[model samples]
Target: MHDRPAPTPTPRSALPVQARLIVAVGIASALHVGKLPPALPLLAQELGLTLVQGGFLLSMIQFAGMTLGALLGQLADRLGPRRVMMVGLVLLAAGSALGAVAPGAAALLGTRGLEGVGFLMTVLPAPALLRRTVTEPGPLNRALGWWGAYMPIGAATGLLVTPLAYATIGWRLTWAVLAVLAALCAAGVRVYVAPDGPRARDAQAWAALRHGLHTTLSAPGPWLVASAFLMYSGQWLAVVGFLPTLYTEAGWSPARVGWASALVAGVNLTGNIAAGRLLARGVAPRSLLWTGYGAMALGAVGTFTAGAGLAYASALVFSAVGGLIPGTLFALAVRLAPGPQTVSTTVGWVQQWSSLGQFVGPPLVAALAARVGGWQWTWTVNVACCAVGALLAAALHARLAQQVRAPRPGQEGA
Candidate 1:
């Protein structure tokens, strides 16, 4: 008799359309974050802004995420991710529009701050929403993996398009264009994503808030995940943020610099998507993370030290392979949540650290480069971050292993 064939597992590509829509919302928010980079030179010229002020403008969007990410995450869990996200989109639209008309740096900075808060709200609860949207593990992994790429995807789109937009219509109109895009995204979310209505009262709300915060904050899982993200994010943003300057100094044109930087950011999606597929196929999350961090360490070292030709290639490999970390961490966030109710809170914690890293990383790298009179020593700082991240990944893997082998009492069979 012929041996029977095993049943085929569901394809990762089978993610639901609504889930994809949710991921698009995230991408839209990320576009807003990225739009300002290319516009910085124009802004500095128009506003007569100093270097310090310019740095603030770039990082202002992270203010809310740095200060209130966890709190917003808890809020999203209580009120509803869809509704909060809609509010976030509206804020992004308003901030972009307002910033477009600003008379000076002060006004523009304030608008950017509002955009930051909006961005925080838009992204904090996404993982939980994705978790709820995609119930099955295989498709969910793929979905979450794609979800992780939303940042680089949005950032790359903004980096590549904004400079072109500026050349055609000027910076003010470029800002207005993103405002329109944000508005459209808000409408899409309202129509497509199901809204959860307001829950009872302040009493129940307070209790839920406490529970979510405690659950996320008390767990070692969330801490490890958040810290690992911190280490990876700071270095990633620092390198990508400065690439345009580095290339321009080497005599690349404005257009070439923009496209090259965008491409480096864009290729990160390959690893993000692959991580989901590999996880769905039962690859160990720990292994993927180790590989990512290791690549980042080696890549940064080469990018700073190697000749120009190989440096770019190393950065590309660094970004592509490093994509595995976020994709895996996102999958792990859902699994390692203290319970169903706290998933968003855990993600919020991750976002909080991520914001902190982005806020600090660029400035830290800039300071180091200034001190050394060049970027030659850049790798020394970033490689340290990668090393720490790898260590944290090991700790997280051990924790996950423990949880898997010793399932909770009621969940033993499961």
Candidate 2:
């Protein structure tokens, strides 16, 4: 039987600085995402937010992604990834600066939703930009894996640091500082990354983009991948977003909760980096996906039901292993795309579902918690999501394997 050739290990030095910078910018963009979890408590107290409203604040960033990820992605392809990313950074900075002065929960929610737009614009074009710049398959795969790590790394950084900033300065000032950092990152992107080139002509670009969108939307592969991401993203965000609150309610100190939750989120990098190396070594994406989902299920059960030490440990394992799903899915997004032109569109589709999961997850979980009077029953949601994700992964694996074993055009007889 014919098989796809395994990707060779790419040395770190062989990866381009430009590609690394793009990942850095992604991490920086994610800092905004991570900033909120730690601050949710203070915001709740100062603004008199209910648990449901907190969930709204947690999910507001997904607003743009849920609504217009594909549209903006097509725009990036037509205009330029770098250009869209720059605009996203500006919006993020503006949103943050505005959020600093938001007088009430409603106003803060509005700012957060706007920031979601910026977040969507910043990340949706990343994979395509990386594809354009990092031409080699091995490096590209590894780079995409690191791209998956951007959230956890940035989120963990925010979880760890935001508490200190809030304690010393204040949430508003901390938010303003992050805004400044985002602006600086935008400048860095301009200096470090090359432009995606002259903008496409309106008619021609629109036609191409429309075609790419059609190709992306019509394919079963994109749909399956996006669905699987939806399953994974919702629970992951729900758990991570509420960890500070969970621990706080358990009577842990603010510093302790901040650092501990950061650790859980940070360890996710392990699986993400490993998924890249495993894929390079030719591990089946299906296996990695199932393993990630399985771990998440078991870990969530333990995290909610077990003793404190065990629960914390389980949370760490849940995050670390759960990392495999996003990294593997990202690698699959590249391979499963209908054509080179549709890579961003495919990623945008993936992000759209991912954002939907994020947008819906926290609020749903919060509502559940509100109804049940605690977080203990939240494991049911995680288990359900993981099961759905596993089924999707199985289907995706079979489809990918079939594609690999199918004959090339000139080699039908071989």
Candidate 3:
């Protein structure tokens, strides 16, 4: 018998539509994370949560990512990105539905942990999926850029919608609505996206997974990327996560706070898109990283120390510039993966560190605020994180340069 022909690649025309569907799924998963900030004040009233507890609540959804991101990545590589993501969406729906009925803080926290796992499952495989789907270099960069923006887009949408929903239907119903959205998104993914390739035998699967994990862990690229994300994500989440609470404390109305915070989060997508364009135009990733971190530090200072008008302006600037980091990191994760088979694994490792930063940053900032009795010292934490990020960027630059200088297998001494 003749050997079977290779499967045809996704047609260029269909690529954009499928990519959009994948991004839509990601945005839906992120809604669970973003929905909480707007509802936090109400939760405090009903749940009797303290500031520190609220901080934990904000970070709780990352608990699974902090622990299981890499393992799930390997699982994605072994099973299929599409399958993994669909399962994730179902779990997200379940978690949100459960959270809607949670009677107290502890029960809500448990549901948040479930949501975390779903979020990780949905998002961790996405960059790799995009890589497989969008073949052209320029469009691939742009798609990854949009993928990078999914969180901000979803979170901003959540911020804008949640307060209105809370006013009309209340937070519980808002959660239920998002759960439905997740289910819908999963159905879209199933219908639109391509299925995974055939699975390898068990022995081959185990061997490939082992190799992917080792390759991802041993490489400096993933570690550098993960470390930079750690520095960026912690401060970014801490500041943005508390914005609703901060505004409420300052006596702003819920509607006003929702709009303002949404604007801050929305501008982040602009930077994310810009980073992809810049990279495609040959801009250095390290340069973008440094600019993002520096701007974040300056914005943090203004946000904390300046008067009201400048403080709000600083927040917008902070979020917009800081957006460059994730877009660049996503591109780097794909470019720097040790092998084609290891892309999701590498992203998983990077995500775990990013989750850890988010997990720790909020509580640390909240503790500081409680100790100092004000938000003035908030700039200190952000600035320190940015400073560390700048140093990591320099190291990453050196690594990239080394890669450029190294010879390909057959090109040695040519």
Candidate 4:
């Protein structure tokens, strides 16, 4: 009686604040990836970067993800996502700072590889962290939707702001400023997010990590989701990454190109948000994916083959509609994880393929452009990706239906 009941904690009340903070951290991390395109022209001039090298630069930041994503995911599982994420943010700051001082293209390229490692570490664990914090399905879906938008938002901001920053402070200072932003983001995560509890002893922890890796890799759900992401990411990055170049070549002013490219990228957020809301309202994931892919196909054709104004409009449609793929895939990754312990590993696996797509996509498109002497043929790549994605979406639908009909032991008869 004297003790009275301990004050009840309301996680629901705190959910929005925590979720927003987590998303903010993701956005800050994404700024590093987005900062490149706007600065590419300046970097090329200053560092003597060739066209192919520029494409490599665009894709180089994905190197770590392509090679180490799953392993890092396992590390995240062993270390706790919050700890991994904070460490990643610190790494990003360090990398950006170093990159700011690079003397040549080769040096800058090396720093970009370092940034790639940090990028994988920072983003791979985010979906799992969100799942752990937001337990309710509806809110979780919406939160994931926003999580998916972080890249486009950060990228769009970078596109719009970098030219202005370059005019005033130059690219080197801009890099330094981003480095500072990443550090602040890390600090914010430490103060606002709850700490991960104690760890298991070494042997048991290692065994558990091994088990999670095995389970995640062996699961069909992870593989299918990963494949779908591979199909979507390559094409998306290729289109968006080159838009600034495309506009520049068209004789638009730097400011005009920045603003226009930013708007195209920014519109993608709408589709991401819409996907989450639709999922929350009981819409079929397959339907949304199909619609997204179809629109992407149509948009790609229009973007490349049509006149300038129509092409810009088509780019908007391509990005906005294609946004549905990532939103749905994130939600699916959580739901389709073999178990709670495997969520990050599953996400890591998915991210690896996504990075592969990004790593290959830009270079492939660039080569194609060089070969054809224009971007008109770019639609073929996007269309092929869309076709493969549609087939994968169908397979995913079947897999989900099978899962529903044969629920896991704990979920049976519920």
The candidate maximizing TM-score is 4
Task: Report the lDDT tens digits of candidate 2 across residue range 1-414.
Answer: 434223233465576777788888888888898999988888878988888888988989998889897778878877888899999999999999999999998889889988998888888888987877776767778888999899999999999999999999999999999899889988988887776667778899889888878878988888999999999898999999999999999999999999999999899988998998899878989999999999999999999999999999999989999999999999888788776667777888899999999999999999998999888899999999999999999999888877679843433442
> By TM-score, how accurate is candidate 4?
0.96
| Model 2, residue 17: C-alpha shift (Å) | 0.8
Q: How high a TM-score does candidate 3 get? A: 0.95
TM-scores of all candidate predictions against the true structure: 0.94, 0.94, 0.95, 0.96
Clashing pairs in 2: 61-116
Question: Candidate 1: deviation at residue 125, Å?
Answer: 2.0
What is the C-alpha lDDT profile of model 4 across 98-148, one tens digit per residue?
999999998999999988888889898888778777767788899899999
Give all candidates' CA lDDT scores.
0.84, 0.88, 0.88, 0.87
Q: Global lDDT for candidate 3?
A: 0.88
Q: For model 3, what is the error of residue 169's alpha carbon versus the real structure, in angstroms, after optimal superposition?
A: 0.5
Query: Whole-model lDDT for model 4 versus the true structure?
Result: 0.87
Q: What is the lDDT of residue 5 in candidate 1?
A: 24
Clashing pairs in 1: none
What is candidate 1's lDDT per residue for 1-414, written digit by digit as tens? 434222233455676666888898888888886787777777767898754465567778888888888889889889888888889889989999999999999999899999999888888878877876776778888989999999889988888888888899998988898899899998997877666655649999999899889878998999999999998887887787678767867999879988998988888888898999999999998899999999999999999989988999989988899999899998888778787778788888888898888888877887788778888998988789988998998999899889989875444543
The segments of candidate 2 whose C-alpha lies over 4 angstroms from its true place after superposition are 1-13, 406-414
Please, what's the RMSD in Å of model 4?
Answer: 3.0
